[model samples]
Target chain A: MFALILPAVLVVAALLVGPMVLLARISLNQYSATQLMIEATTAQNYLNAVADPYYRGVMLTTLVMAFICTALTLALGFPAAYRLARMESRWKSLVTVLTLIPLLVGNVVRAAGWLGLLGNDGLINATLRGLGLTSEPLRLVYTPGAVAVGTIAVVLPYMILTLSSVIESIPRAVEEAAANLGASAFTVFRRVVWPLALPGTVAGCVLVFILCMNTYATAVLLGGSQFKMMAPAVYDQFSKGMNWPFGAALAFILLAATLVLTVLGTALLGRRYAR
Target chain B: MGQVRAGPGPDTVTREAVTRMRAAPLSPLAAPALAGPGLSVRLGRLAFLAAVFLAYAIVFAPIVMVVVTSFFDQEIVTFPPDGLTIRWYLNAWAQRDFARGFLTSLQIALAATAIGVPLGTAAALALVRATIPGRGFINTVLLAPLAVPAIVAGSALYMFYLRAEDWLDMDIKATLGGLVAANVLITIPWTVRLVTASLAGLDRAAEEAAANLGARPLTVFTRITLPMLRPGIVAAALFSFVASFENLELNLLLVGPGRTTLPVAMLSYLEFRMDPTLAAVATAQILMVTILMLVTDRFVKLSRIV
Candidate 1:
């Protein structure tokens, strides 16, 4: 067994655990523009991150946007997931393939797609003009809305896929029994289906939320420079600012926030389920 | 049946049609209330299905637009183009950076898949079949890469590489070798998950029977286990290759000069330009992934990929 697992352990230790430790070490070191990082250890980066209003604002925006995106994804994805779950037709596999195609497309490509549609002179605006909806094209790109829309598109497949399987696990007979008992469709859905699907809902939301929190390309491409989110900020610090220590500090903070929120959300959802 | 009577052959046919139609409404199994109890409910259902169709359209529109616009005869990516042509494809082909980047990405993806598959499969075997304590924790640790943001992983590995180079006096950072390592790290979880699932569902009685027949463990594994794992291995390798190929954040951070991958190259171009050439490149990527996925679907149900 040890022999079987040894290669995996080595790879994990060398790649993930080792790099994380090195990242933490770098986070504690002094930032140097020329040498990448100073040998001396300090908490200056963390201190600055905590003290700065800009970082705090960015953090808040990241949290708020992530929450909003999670809610949106859940709302938009649920119905489709229901369709996929209840479907018995041969079209199930076709729909499933359609759902996963976006995931297969890289983030850059997805962002590029959004650019095509969301740009001022893009398809939507051109259509609206052709239909005479407005005199001039409206600005949609590089806004918070664009970011949310793009991120939702990015994460919706995960939500749908998760909830479909979860809902599918529920026996159809249970629903049939409720219907046979003269329960309204709404009541059966509300009382029988909703409660049973809570765990999947929680899992899917948490996953999507964390993914939204860590999004970089979407924020950079869709949100643009005017909007600053956590992941892009971290990337900026490390790559553009040449501040590895500060970047690492910011990354750890995001990690902590993500973990804390996930746990808190899960606990809250668990309690709600019990109720 | 109660009021109408047949007079002749034509009247008899009309009576039969009426009887069949009347029987449909009487049969509860044939006509559920949800299908059309009231105009409001029917309209609501129609609206719901329309919304679902609209959602799917929204999801596919962007990807479809990229492919459609690639054939635009104009220079820019405008809708309702002047005409259809393959000029952008030719332009994309002529772009040397994209060609080189495509080759580089292919090389890296192939290398990463080659290294990650065996290690991941071995680990998965232990994870699925081996009797060990704390296997849950091992599973979590092994799959933790999925949760870690690629940007963070990239930054961490970039720092680690720099530090390691300082200590070992070897230049490995920003090289193809370094890329392979990072890509392998990110991709192993997927391989392990798919194979572990396949291995879990497998019947291991054949291997046990072989052992009972006095076959050596290695022979049993080679002849029995490996053959059983073929489908999973193929799927895992495909996934690993795609994951590595589609990766951008890590490549953006670790890619050296003249070593840009296709995604990285696309990102840089996107930062500067907005033309149908990008549409061409995206179409190429979509086509490649679609073909690969279709091939994999022949071997396994595509729905199980999630």
Candidate 2:
């Protein structure tokens, strides 16, 4: 049994755990122009990241954008998930497959699709022009709105799938009993379905929120060069700026933010709904 | 409205029967019967259906838009005036970088899937069947890579590889071997997740019975457990392949200058030009993934694992 698990443990320890440990160590080091990174134990890199307005703004933008996208996806996904869960029609399987389609399509490809739809000369602008709704093409692409839409498109399927599976487990008899007791549809949902589905909803939100925070391809493609986010900023620091220590610090910050929020969100939601 | 009471009156019984009938699986739109029958209820159902349709439309619009834009006859993608043509697909195929990148991605994905699946399967089996203490901790560690942001993981690996190259007195960063290692790291998590899920549904009676009958553990595992785990292993392979193939952020920092993956190549092209050629490439990927998924579904229900 130990032999069976040894190979995977070794690989993970070497590849994933080793690098992360190194990353944590490097984040506290000093950045030098010629040396790339200096061996030191200083919190300067983390301080610079938090203190600098540009990096701070990037963090804030990422947080705000992730929150908005999470809210939007949950709002849009809950109904679709509920409908899919209770659906008895033959189209249920077909619709479920359709939902899975976007997940299989990689983010870069999906981002490319968004480019075709939201670009200046893309579909939406052309359609607007054809309909005589606008004289000039609206600036759809490279806007925060485009980024939000792209991110939501990427994450909504995950939210829906998670919620639907959870919703599917809640017995139909419970809802029927609530209805028979003269509760309205809203009341039935609020009293029975909502409480039962809370755990799944929280799980979905955490998953989607974390995904949103780390969004890279969508943010780059849809948000463009001017737009800044934590993931892209971390990449730019490592690749273009040659600031390894700062990049490591930024990476840790992003990871911490994701972890902290996920735990916090789970705790708050879990506590509120705890019986 | 007053007919449905808590007591077992005849009116209440009839109402319950009607509610049960409405909730039956035969109803095409079996919405919960919390609402009474009326114009308002009909309108609400119509609205709910429309919302679901709109959600699906949003989900598919980007994919459909890419395929549509790929056929635009013009050099630049303007909407209405252009005729349809397959030239963009030809153009995408003509790009040397894309072709090379596609081959690189294919090689890497295959290699990653080959190496990652078995390791993940073993780990999952051990976690499931063995009496290992701290199994939960080990499981979390195995799946941690999936939660770590790809860019963070990529850069961390890049830095680590650079350091390793210095110590080992050899090149590692930006090499094909290093990229495969990184991809394998990612593929392991998916395999662990799917295989673990599959293992949860498995029956242990066969293995126990085989053990009782004096069969060697290896023989029992190879003959019975492995055969039963076929669907899970296959699904894991497919998913791991897709995960490696479609990876961009992880491969972004790790890829060498000349050794770009297809997605990285596409990103580079997008930076330079906004043509239908990339659209053509994206459409091909979409079609390929769709077919792969549909074919896999024919064998194993992905919903069960995914």
Candidate 3:
């Protein structure tokens, strides 16, 4: 096992962890991007990140947005997943294919597409206006809502695919057995299949939750500078903001948060299902 | 592959069609004998599926619109233009560095897949086939890369490349090799997971039998396991290749001067000007993605690969 995966392990370690420690070191150092040189170590950058209220807001908003998105995905996802799992006709395969098509499109294209869809003179607003639904173009573009919409669209596929596969695994005999013993479809579903598929649902929810938390593209494209998220803030601090130590601190903190979620999710979901 | 025994069970007509199946098999034909999802709850689910379909339509509308808007020569962003024209496609095609950018992206993506897929498969085989100590811990640690946001990944790559240049006193950032190095790291998990799943479900008997029969391990592997693993490796390589091609975030951070992938170039252009021509470029990208998704889906089932 070790030998087969040795090369992949090395590459990931060198690219992922090596740079993380390097960034940590750079973050601690009085790094100079201009001269491209670093002075000896200092704690100033870390202090700036923790002390600043602006950075605080960024972290808070990111966490809040991630959770909100996760909740929205679950709420919207459950019914669709249930329907897909119970699908009749030859359409089940088509539906499965349809759900996955979105994954093929890159984030850049997806974000750009949303810009057109939600812009002031975009089709959505135009349709709304034509229907006399509103007087003015409701600040649809460049809002937190737009960010949520884009994020949901991108992440929805993962949620649906994961949840549906789990749902499909529920044996019909168990449901029939429940119904045979004087249970309705709903009762049988609630009592049996729901519990059976809970692992997949939980896994999907956990994955979505973490991806949303780690997200940067949707935030950058939809929220812009004002509607901050944790990942993008970490990004700006390193790139445009030009504060290495603070950025590194934020990155470490974000990494820590994701790790916590993964552990909790595994304990809560994976170990129980044991699939 | 998962198999479903078509037709209803214990039927003279349906059973004649097939011996056995899995899941609720489709009736040989839609007949009065068949029942839909329960009538009481059936409407509810149908309505829900309809709503989901509408949502899917909304999600897909942008790509559809881009394809429509791409043909516009109006030069301005508008829905109902003067008339549909194909001039924008020509302009997009002839645009400076756009062709070069496309070639660069293709080259980088191909090179990255060449390195990444085999390494990932090797990793998967090692992790799954061997009784290595701490294999689970090592696999999780390796996949931890995906948990990091692309921005951080890009930043790390940029910084590393910069330092490498400093140490070697040679340019490394703008080169194809640098792009491959960054993308290979990003795409490894996909190939590893795909190959590992394939390996896990694989028939080990052929190789074992071959070894006993006096065929060398290498010969057995080439004849038996490699043929079986080909579907998975191809699918993984294709998926990783497409991803590498369209990767904007990492490229945005690490793509050095004088050479930019198509996506990074489009992003830079859009940062300054948003035009219908960009839509043309976007349409071309969508076309590539459509083909890629089909190819990958055919070779490897997404559910199993992950």
Interface RMSD for every prediction, one decimal? 12.8, 7.5, 5.8
lDDT of 3 by residue, A81-177 (tens): 7667656566776677667767667766777777777777666787888888987887887889888888888787778777776766654445544
What digit string (tens of lDDT, one per residue) describes model 2 on residues B114-233? 999999999999998889988989988898888889999998899999999999999887678988999998789889988888888899999899989999988998999999999888
Instruction: Give every collision pair in model 2.
Output: none
Model 3 agreement with the true structure over B217-239: per-residue lDDT tens digits: 78987888789899989888888
TM-score of chain B of 3: 0.83
Instruction: Please identify model 2 stretches exceeding 4 Å from their true place.
Output: B1-36, B211-214
Stronger candidate by TM-score (2 vs 3): 2
TM-score of chain A by itself in each prediction: 0.95, 0.97, 0.86
- Two-way TM-score contest, 1 vs 2, winner: 2
Give the true-structure RMSD of model 2.
5.2
Instruction: Please give the range of 10 consecutive residues that has the lowest summed lDDT in model 2 chain A.
Output: A168-177
Which tens-of-lDDT digit does each residue in A1-275 have in candidate 2? 88988899889899989999999999999999988878999999999999999999999999999999999898888889888877667676666767787897888888878888888888889899989999989999999999999999999899888888777766666666676677766677788878888888888899999999999988898897889999999999988999999999999999999999999999999898897
The DockQ figures for the candidates are: 0.35, 0.48, 0.35
The candidate maximizing TM-score is: 2
- Candidate 3 Cα errors over 4 Å, as ranges: A1-4, A31-43, A87-94, A131-135, A180-186, A261-275, B1-43
Fnat of all models, as shown: 0.40, 0.48, 0.29
Which digits, one per residue and each the tens of the lDDT, describe model 1 over residues A1-275?
87978888789889988999889888899987688778768889888998999999999999999999999788778778878877667888878877876877888888888898988778999899889997788989999999988888888888888887777666555555576677766667787777887788888998899999998888888887789999889988977898889999998989989999999999998897785
